[model samples]
Target: MTHLTLSDYDISAERGFLCRYDAPDVELHGKMAAVRNVAMALPKTLVTGRLRDLMLRDLPNNVEADDIADLTDEQARMAMVHYSFLIQAYVWGEADAPALLPRALAVPMHALAERLGQQPLLPYSGYVLDNWGLFDADRPIDLDNIFMIQPFLGGQDEAWFVLVHVAIEARAGKVLAAIPTILNAIATGDTDTVRVELEGMATHWAAINALFDRMPERCDPHTYFTRVRPYIHGWKDNPALPGGLIYEGVEAFGGKPQAFRGQTGSQSSIVPTMDALMQVGHADDPLKAYLDQLHIYRPPGHRKFIDDVRTQSSLRHFVEGAGDRDLTLAYNAIIQAVADFRSRHLQYAASYIQKQGKTSAGNDPDVGTGGTPFMKYLKKHRDETKARLIDA
Candidate 1:
């Protein structure tokens, strides 16, 4: 069987998705400048009005199969990158009222992905796989190495929050690389190899937790809640967007509707990797279920990579060993912190989702408005891991 590399999917560009970050001549650049001017000079209502109009009028709404054929290779690539940032800003810039993304932006984005043979959204796996070499544990975290562009119109608070996830995703990439070795050890009953791999896994979790700890220093709570948090809102229940974001020409798998519930894009990435590491495989494990459903959001190769990791057994044996106390504690702390992170996101959702006249209640078995099941699983996993350490 052939394995996939990031280059196979045309995602190996050094700049990640921000290909237009330096492109000042693109039509999208002019529109972005206009939006920023309005944001700085106008009232909140006026800013939103201007942005909505710009989105509907300025951006390319109707994308067909032959659209990219008309452009040079570089032009097509820049168009995709430019539109990626535009979609993020249009959907997430407004705090209380995120505009429903029209076909102009949405269709072209989907078409761009199809043209490139990639997924519509920048899946977390792509970030990890494409940038695998940059994720050295010994190196200092560099904000510039992040996969997504710094929101051109967003503030420092927004930039910091995005960097934090970029750092965490780097750490996740390291963990993902080691998983096959750990699983190989488990399959062969190599306890010593398993112990070593588990230790490394714990270290990766610590690094992720450290990034979370640094969030306050980079972005204060006030700025985060007010500026950055609102951008991550999903379309679960807002009256304005009844069916959430609809990708034209994208059909739901298994005959379900092709609407996306509101979510922070990277939120689905790290926690699921940790959950797989600890083997928290309860029947109601929300992370596991969510990950299973989330494959559709990823490219085919990325989906295969995630599935390979999930199918492995949990590393519970290492916790039962006599010298694994620190590893156990580190593992428990990581799970707890992830659960806390999810809880905080829920609080943010509560404040914004319902205020827009959208139902915060989610009916998806994989995910809901409140992440109650995932939280419960994390708590149970943490307690059980601690108990095993004590008993050992």
Candidate 2:
């Protein structure tokens, strides 16, 4: 019964699930400017105690949930981005992470995270979705025109890694736009319309995979494992922080440790959305459980979109029964695309994280940033998707 319109979920044909926020606006001035100033310099200030020093001196104080509640949606999102980056740097920037987050950082970050309905740390929405801007407003959000607005180390590798994800999110708009059309076409038994839309969806997916293929162009595997991967890790399931992280002054936490998943590509709603549309179900397993846990990490609207697509779509069932060669072929093409993307992602997981040597306690090479034995499940999901293809 849920409407499938993009705007209903704050999504769009131009940006897909990516946040519509652009950086460097007049709104980020005044009180919030201090947060951005500190975040912009986080990479350069990552000496043993330098980040902590900069944060205590430079970060604004007395930020409460009420203050976040007063701002417009854009300002709130910007605040989340700045505060999330600063919190991650404070926790992971040094050689050893501190068990306790100071009251100054903990209080504001907790309030912002509460207001945004996410955990009090970096999230995919803040990390990649909202953490980007255009080099030139007139150009598209392609790799050439886009750059990461916030980064842990601000290197070519880091920027390239994040920017590639952004580019894929932009390209996904077309595929998302086709969802309702395909579903409605299925309902009307309009096989031709369904076939055309499925073909288009598969084409857009190919472009997304092309973007994924460029991951190593600038983000070296070793650099990604050491520099880029370490800071984004959350405390849960991490051997380094067995007790999890403590937010010293976030009264809601009662001085106990908090555990949340790190920002990983799995949190992106694109694959989930596609899975929902195709009705590709994963057997309940550790990876499925981890993915279910990550559902809350996404923006609430995205969660709704995925759920609606799953419940409402009859594409797979229709294709299986249509007995139309072209329609079944179109549906099979999309299934194959999803399978291929997962396979490439599995390869990257092995090369980018699994094969790389361990450099820090927090970043376990065997575990994914989201805290799963990813290699085993990535293969499972890929095979499951491929098996869903309609048989001739």
Candidate 3:
């Protein structure tokens, strides 16, 4: 019944989204447009908190370009971690709940997914290739999270569907400025309307990335990030972790079996150290956190797929620097996982082909003579993906 907007959250003012863009002339205007559009969409009461006044409206029109750049990239990166889980939360959990995005959505991998998906997979974490496969499809449930549903009665469909929006939003902050527009269409569940937004998201990513790249990060990444090193791995310069966002408060949801298991214990961070053999690890790896993020991304198949991610993460980390013997063993184990999945699918598809065989109205047109439907799907998808997603 109600619409979704980002102003409902406390972190609205602190969000570092626009800073990542180098819009000297447009920076302040861009910031205002982003905030006002969302703020105006919701009741003024929602956006009028003290800091919101201070943070949203009071910042100087000539806000320092440098501070914007630095703060924004950090927050933009942080946005993905929170945004990823919010999708899942909106899809599966209570709509009127507190900021689950802040608490449950703090995993590094999801942030990394945002980073890669936004930045184009070059500096990407190794886990992405094995775990994620996204086609640019938007669902009727996009923005179905706590922030939106608290006022509406969005059950699973609404909650799970929000993830489609989160994935798009994290990388394209400008689109987030247009949340009301998107949700209005999503609420209608009109295929044509949803398609318009989805196409915009694809282009918004292109334009935003282009904006960020226009200004050379005057502050070097090495220098910029070094300031964060003391905070990131618990070195204790500021007595806080990244985002001052404490993560220990998160809990494991049993329904999503793999959710946070590998992430939970550097030891349990998936199938446990004994099972996964700790192939990959860091003091603050965010594997568990990522699961919390994934929790809302796919509510219907939440447990199985998250378990898949957890299993995938642990196995990936297990033999990073392993010896020849260990490498061979680990590689074989991965090979088996791939083979088993492929074999199962192959069998299922084969059966479908067999059914088609019995129903053939005409004579068998040479079983292996021409290409099969599966082959066409695989080949077409592969070529299209390469052409569209891969940069020359």
Candidate 4:
């Protein structure tokens, strides 16, 4: 019934089931192109509001008051592009889903974004659309060159794995993309657009959380850690990875330093995505308990994240010819980072529960990026997500 094939999640297609986005069996390549076109067209649909005028006209000129206003102009522009692309992915995934031997799980995802008004975050296919193009005043950015080599666990029991990829893609395209929109639209009174965006984003968030599958068997953690982790960060040092996506660079002044993993909906609280991964291997009591437990050394609630980033920072340096001593330091730094993260998370969790009620899911997951600060932001405004779900 669904359009997924074993190939969608698994690299080997051990069950011979993955759906091809651009294969001979289907006009996926063409559809892919069409999807990009449609997603790219969405921002143009936004008519300028007085807020828009203020963002464009007032923010840049007046540097004293609401300094963030100048910053948000660019943020809103990029946010617009993100929503448009996710919607495009939704349509493409829909058309391509049933036609492929297996459905592309991302179809329903793209559909969710279409309805909600968010866009894809993994934006792997986003390169095709040139989100960077929004800022490009000179040349065109090439995105089609990027091909996906999605690796997942496949064989007889790979159903969950395949479904999981669907969730990842959906989150990337749907949920994560809407965080800024949901958070920012309140300022602009464009709650209608964001209401839709939040619902669609929630669709992806719910899907990503639903996946209880494991990564492909016999694969390497080093592969995930070394090869994959940095990819999520867009090899922050790599020239190919755009600086805009890299959160720490000169390009980002008003924002905190962050690294996004995949186009998967990491746009929101990337920390939640990290939480999802840390907990992914476990379940129920194990995950719940693990999530509840706090480490003494690491920050209040961010032990895992700090550790990962410090390790990643070391790994990045090692790639550039750092010594083993540096690598050793990296490992130690990761531990310290974890300790620090844990400390902050405690403060964050308490604050979040205070505002959103104790049982609230804290649904939006931030990926490798920092968690607590954004969690606070999302917790305060989480009602917007619910408000979006209201049927018009």
Residues 115-145 of candidate 3: C-alpha lDDT, one tens digit per residue: 3343101111111111122232242111322
User: Under the 3 Å rule for N, CA and C atoms, how many clashes does model 3 have?
Assistant: 25
For residues 1-392, write the lDDT of model 4, one tens digit per residue: 12222222321211111112222112112333333333333333222212222222211121122221332322322332333334222222221211111112133233322322333233423222112211232421112122222211112222222233433343344332343343344335443553365345445444444342233332233333322222122212222233323121122223333222233222222334323322212233422332332122121112333333323222222212323343334323322332333333334334322233211111122322211223434332332222222111
Task: Give the TM-scores of the predictions, in the order they appear.
Answer: 0.63, 0.97, 0.24, 0.22
Mark the regions of model 4 whose C-alpha exceeds 4 Å error after superposition. 1-122, 126-163, 167-209, 212-227, 235-264, 267-373, 378-383, 387-392
- The candidates, ranked best first by lDDT, are 2, 1, 4, 3
Tell me the RMSD of model 4 versus the true structure. 24.1
Candidates 1 and 3: which is better by TM-score? 1
The whole-model lDDT of each prediction reads: 0.48, 0.87, 0.27, 0.28
Task: List clash counts for every candidate, in order.
Answer: 7, 0, 25, 52
Model 2 TM-score relative to the real fold: 0.97
Q: Which candidate is the best by TM-score?
A: 2
Candidate 2, after superposition: displacement of residue 248 in Å?
2.5
* Model 2: number of backbone collisions: 0
